[model samples]
Target: MTTFYILVGYLALLMGLGLLSNRFFKGTSADFFVVSRSVGSFLLLMSIFGTTMTGFAIVGSTAKSYTDGVGVYGLMASWSGLMHSAVFFAVGIKLWAVGKRYGYMTQCEYFRDRFESDRLGYVLFPILVLLVIPYLLVGVIAAGKFIQPTTAGLFPEAFPMPNLPNGNPHPLNGGIPPAVGGGVICLIVLFYVFFGGLRGAVWANTFQTIVFMGTGVIAFYMISKNLGGLKAASEAVAASDFGAERLGREGMMSKLQFLSYCFVPLSVGMFPHLFQHWLTAKSAKSFKLTVVAFPLFIMIVWVPCVLIGIWAAGYLGPLDPGQSPNSVLGRMVGQLVHSPVLTGLVGAGVLAAIMSSLDSQFMCLGTMFTNDIVMKKYGADRFTDRQKIWIARGFILFVVGATYLLAIALQDSAHVFDLGVWCFSGFAGLFPLVFASVFWKRVTLPGAYACILSTALAWGYLFYHDILAAKPAGVGDEEMLVFGMMPVAIIIAISTVSLVVVSLLTKKPSEAIIRKFFV
Candidate 1:
């Protein structure tokens, strides 16, 4: 009960802080969407890093590491740490410059202008929304999974879930069910985002990043101490027959799989939320810290979560049949930390990491709909600043409702890591469009269109064949990988070929169009 109250208190404090930040809101659409483009260096870094490292980083990594061994770190964190920073430096800074110059608010706006096609937004807007919803689902699913187990046994009498015929509590029986947990989180995020907009998200992200990271360090320390320190923990894992292979290269991952994972991080280059964050930078110099420190931040969050998951195999032993891999982290925290107060704090930290990213994603979707769809197609001049903000808010509420429904429906679906990879792969497949639009002068509007279409077709086919089909029988990454490689590799290859082949074969853009973007 004390733990539950602590969790509630933490959420209330966050909501208050978020609503209070509206005092600084300039009450314009620009301020709501991009914070008047006045965000400083440190806030920009924290916000970018925080938004990127959502439940996918914490919950997904722990679950994957537990299932695949320590090699999960190399498959994602190592590559992402290096690739994410490189992409930020190479792609983010350039986009920020163009966005500042052109007064662009969304990724589709940049594409529409760069390609000189009003219809491009009509095509790209739906695709971007399609990709972003999965990302949002990952956060919602992970938050429910985290909260469900952490709050278990607290209200067993009131919220009694079905149990086994043998009288034991069901593995999934808990304090709050997925629907309620997801709904509460969505409402909190919506309140802050609705009032404070991007400003609220950035401020909330900065605060949540500190809370999660600081408490993450404490969780790691206490877990290690409980298990007789790092040395003993490693030895126990090494000695356990169940997880001994996790300590070696052969048991972790294959060479091709490891190399293919590198492409997954490329998805960051095309994230709509990330694009919005880049545009919020006060100057190009604001990106310097983000590029340098992102890898370190990845390490800070990933290493502990990965290590904890790896230890869980030895500590908790084997899982029962029909159990969720996502619950491993929360279960471990609950068991390892004997103090109820400590358990609540650790749970709050995990929730912070999950929610920090959700706000940005939800807000970005709203910004895109208002700026790209309503204002661009319908005309911004027709709507006042407050009206525009309301338009965005209304669209965002619709999105929130849709996503919440999906989160509930897919509660028993794929692991967070796999779902996230599928989502990121869709974005990564479209990376060629952005990369060529900036660097390659010959890329035509037709080529961009081809890239979008090809990527979407491939993503849809693979997702249905690999994920949705196999999900019924509990198939996961082990069964989903094609020839020991991920589906992203195939999608990227197809998208790149479509872009290049179509661009060379088609007529080039007019000189003025080329000069506006390229020269």
Candidate 2:
């Protein structure tokens, strides 16, 4: 009961912060979309870092490390820390400059102007939304899974998860149901997003970034102490059948597959939510702090989660039949923390990470729908600025509702880490197009079309096939490697090839357009 009240109090604080930020809303579409580009360097850094280090970084990393070993850090976090910073330096700064000068609020707008094809938004909008939904689900799924076990036994009779009549304890018994937990989070996020818009999101993200990172360090120290220090935890693994292999990447995954993961981090280049965050920067100089500080932040957040996961393998032993990897972090925290108030704080940190990313994604998608679809295709002159804001608000309502429903439906089949990798893969495959648009003057409208279409097709095919393909007869995750590499390698190749080939064969953009962007 104390833990539950603490969580409730923490949630109230987040909601209050989000709503309070909305009091600054300027009531214009541009203000609502990008906060009139008035953000400072420190705020910009916090907002960008907050949106990027999501549930996938915290909950998903820990969950996957339990399954695949400590190499999970190398597979995504190390590569992400390096590549994401590079992308911020090379891609993010330049986009911020162009977006500010052109009054652009979304990526689709930039692509349409770069290609001289209004219809390009029509094609690209749906594809970007499709990729982002999975990213949103990662947050929702993480929060729900994290809450369930941490709150268990507090509401034993109130929210009892199913158990055998034989009195055997189900791993999830007495935990909050995934739907109830996920729904409460979605509603809180939606309220702030709906009322405060992007400005609200940025403010909330800054608060969340501070909370999660600070609490994460505290949780790490406490959890390690509770487990008899890091040395004892490692020794536990040393004694178990898991052995020293958990310390390294050996035998858990193929070297080629692991190395090929470098391409996955490229997804940041094309994230619509990230594009909006970049556009919010007041100047190119604002990016300096973000680019410089991002890697350190990533290391601080990721190292703890991954090490805890590896340690769990040693001390916690095997998961039961009904237990999912997502439950590991929650169960471990709840069991080891012992102090109710401290346990709730740890739970809030996890939820903070999840909600920070969700706010950005929700705002970005709603802003995209309004700007690209309603304003561009439907004729913006017909609607007033107030109506435009409401349109965005209404659409945000629809998107969050649909996402929550899907998050519930897919909870059984999809886990957070793998689903996130696949989502990022789709975006990475589309990176060549964005990169060329910014750096290459010769990229043609046909090339941009080919890039977007081919990425959609390749990603759709690969994802659908992965779903339909049979897993091993035993209980293990089996992904079909394309020539012994993850599917992202092939999808990226297909997208890059089609982009370069079709551009050379097609007519280039006019000199006026080239000079507008490049010169």
Candidate 3:
């Protein structure tokens, strides 16, 4: 009853924020799509922070740290936040300057206008859809996982486990009806986002960030207290051979993979939604100033999660067969936290963290698919805002549906942390295209397109081998494949180099195009 009340209160707060912000977001597509380019640095900072430190990672990071030990701390280097900040400082400011100069509303618009190529929009459309859909699935899976167990007790005798062909019980414990936890959360996100648009997303993101961090901090303190303080936890870890042995070579690699996650913020920080957020700044000075604060935000948010992961390791011992450290944080909360009120609040906040990205991610994907992919390819330029809205709505439903199906299909034999790395790898493929588009003046459309295609193929090949193939359980250290951030980094390097070489060898992007984008 206490937990239920706490959850209700959290939802009420979120809905109130959505209702309050909805009025400010009415008007043009830009208003609906990008908050009318009026978001302040504070809003931008919170939005970026919330969206990047999403639910997929917040829970999974603890699990990764639990499984891998202290080595996973290197993953907290805040590469994504750093790179995202740098982009804001360097590339983002410039992108905003040009958007303001050209009255460009979207990244695809920027590409289309700068290159004098409607064809560029065609290329970007599919890329954005592909980039966003799988990523959104991750959030869906995270949310469903979090909510499933929490509310399971509610169903009780009504829940019945399904029988397999071999007569084993269905893997989902007592088979309650499908939770739709992810879908329910998405509907909440859509309610605020549909009416309030980008402003709503920003407002909700700011509030959500505060709630998420506050809850996480409290939960961390409780977790640490229950297990003894951090010093005691450290001593506990030292005493346990689990830290020294199983967490050995492969453990070191997992740490490397964690460190590699830094690139995500770097690459995704420049993503369309982020690019639009950068453009909304009141001034270039504010944009530049905001970068310095993000590193601190990353540290404050991630450190507690990491510490909690370490604590879980000592308390839980080696993860049980078929159990993941990713699940450890929630399980620990379920087992250790005495106060159901705080536990439910913390759980709701975690779900908010997951949905924070789900909303923006789907929105971005919808916009890209509609504006960049579908509209450019087939539709006339004079399409109405209503049409675009409907298209976006349809795409949102599609994205959620696809994610739900994928999560169900992949429920068995997959780890959340590993799935996260795979999704991140897909985005890493975009890093070169983004860099070349913004920085290298000579990077031709063909070169950019080739780089995008090749990087994706290379990334897919790696996933197929490491994830799809029947390799050993811990086969080829986690870092060697999906978790290995460096491999994606290396691919980015190669793709950029290859694009540069190919662009020089081929016809240059028109001189007019170069001057417009560079200027």
Candidate 4:
């Protein structure tokens, strides 16, 4: 009964936020689609940060830490948070200035106008769907993990997750079953997301970000108290063989991986949805202010989640019997928290983290597919706003469906971190294009095209051989080539330098084009 009330409370809060934002959601497609291009720094900052820190970070990172200690920490992508902020200085602020100056509504709108090539915009659009769908899948899967069972008994018919009849041992021994949980989350997320668009997403994310951050502080405090405080928890981790052993294995590789994780934000600030948020901001000053304040939130909020991961090393044990370490957070709450009401709150907080990102992801995928891929490319200038909205809805369904299928197929796979890193690798290749778009002149259309195609081809080829295909005999998978973001960046830098040299020597973008866009 208590769990029932908590679930109701969480849903009501979400709906209320959406209703509140409805006032601001009025006006043209520009207004409704991207908050009327008047979002202030605080709101803009909160939305961007809120969207990026998904349940994947919370659950997947903690799970990896539980199994492998700080070594697996490389897999968490924490540096992405910092890189995302740095990107604001690099491109986000400038993007905002240009967007407002030109009255651009979407990334594609800006690109099409700047390049004066609908053909290029059309070509560039399909990648939006490819980039965004995999991310939405991660969000959906994580949300499903929390919601399916958190409200399991609240509405038996609505949330019919299975459990043991005897209650002696749990199903999957208290771990979530992927498919059943994943679907429920997708349904709830799709409902609000389809209607809400970017406005709905921003409002919901703002409120949920509060819940997520607040809960992290509270949970960290409670966990520390239960474990005899932070000093004792540190001692426990240092004393535990599991912590030491896992850290040792990860050793240099773990630190290297953590640094590699920075690639997330490196490419993230370039992501279309992020550009949308920048465009929505009231001014460049607001955008800069928001970026400045963002790292504080990351340091305080996210750092605690990592601490909790380490704390769990001492507080929790090897995955209960056959359970995977990834299930550690949920399993620990169920076993150690003791009070059902507190357990419900903790579970809901985790769900908030998951849903915050899910809404943004769905909206990002929907908008990018509709505006960039469908309307701009195929429909050209002939597409109506209503038609675009419908296309967005369709992409939402397709993206969700693909992710649902992936969740089922990859259920047995333990390395979710690898999947996420691989999914975002393509953007690393697009870095030079984005950089040159803002700061560098003499970046020709041919140069941009070469950079995008080269990065995609190289990364795609390597990803397929290493990740998709079965490894050949006697070949170590580690030696099999994980080119990752750094390699992709090197490829782009080389390509861009060569292109600039060529363009300057030959046919540069006309002075008129340079002043209009690049300058």
- Estimated TM-score for each candidate: 0.95, 0.95, 0.88, 0.86
| Best-fitting candidate, scored by TM-score | 1
lDDT of 4 by residue, 1-519 (tens): 676467558877787666666566553556656777778877787788777777755666677666556655434444654666778877888888788788776777777766667777877777765776566666656665565556544444543445667764334333335576677666656666666667888878777788777776776677777778889887887788666454454453534444455554566755777777777787777767666766777666656666677777776645566565656666656665555676667766777888877777777667766666666546646866666666777888887777888876765565444556665666666776777777777777777677667767777776777678877797753423244334444444555665565556655677887788654
Local distance difference test, per candidate? 0.86, 0.86, 0.69, 0.67
lDDT string, candidate 2, 111-198, tens digits: 9998998888888898889889988987887788778877777777888766768877766678898899999999999988898888
Model 2 collision count = 0
Give the 10-residue window scoring lowest on summed lDDT in candidate 3. Answer: 170-179
Q: If both were scored by TM-score, which would come out higher, candidate 1 or candidate 3?
A: 1
What is the C-alpha lDDT profile of model 1 across 1-519, one tens digit per residue?
888888899899878878888999888998999999999999998898889888657766788788888888888888988999998998898899899999999998998889988899888888888888888998888787677777777777767789889988786565788788889999999889988899999999998888888777788888889899999998999999877877766856778888888988999999999999999999999999998888898889889988888898788777898776777777777788778888888788888888998999999999999998889877999999999999999998999999999899888875644667688899999998999988888999889989999999998998888656646555545635667788889899999999999999999888887778754
lDDT of 2 at 435: 90
- The digit string of per-residue lDDT tens for model 3 on 1-519 reads 566567667777777878888767556666667776777778878887777778745686687677765555555546645676776777778788887787666788787776567877777766666666666667776676677666555544566555667997655554234346666666677777766666777888888888888888898888778777778866776678665442343635555566555665556644666776676666777674468887777777678887777777667788767675667887778777778877787877887788777777766766666666667666636677767766766776676567777766664535544656666666666767766688888788778767877777787777777667778765654455443456676566667777777788888777778777776
RMSD of each: 2.1, 2.0, 3.6, 3.9
**How accurate locally is residue 62 in candidate 4, as Cα lDDT from 0 to 100?**
70
Candidate 2 similarity to native, TM-score: 0.95
**Alpha-carbon deviation at 386 in model 4, angstroms:** 5.9
Off by over 4 Å in 2: 169-174, 414-418, 470-476
Clashes of each: 0, 0, 5, 0
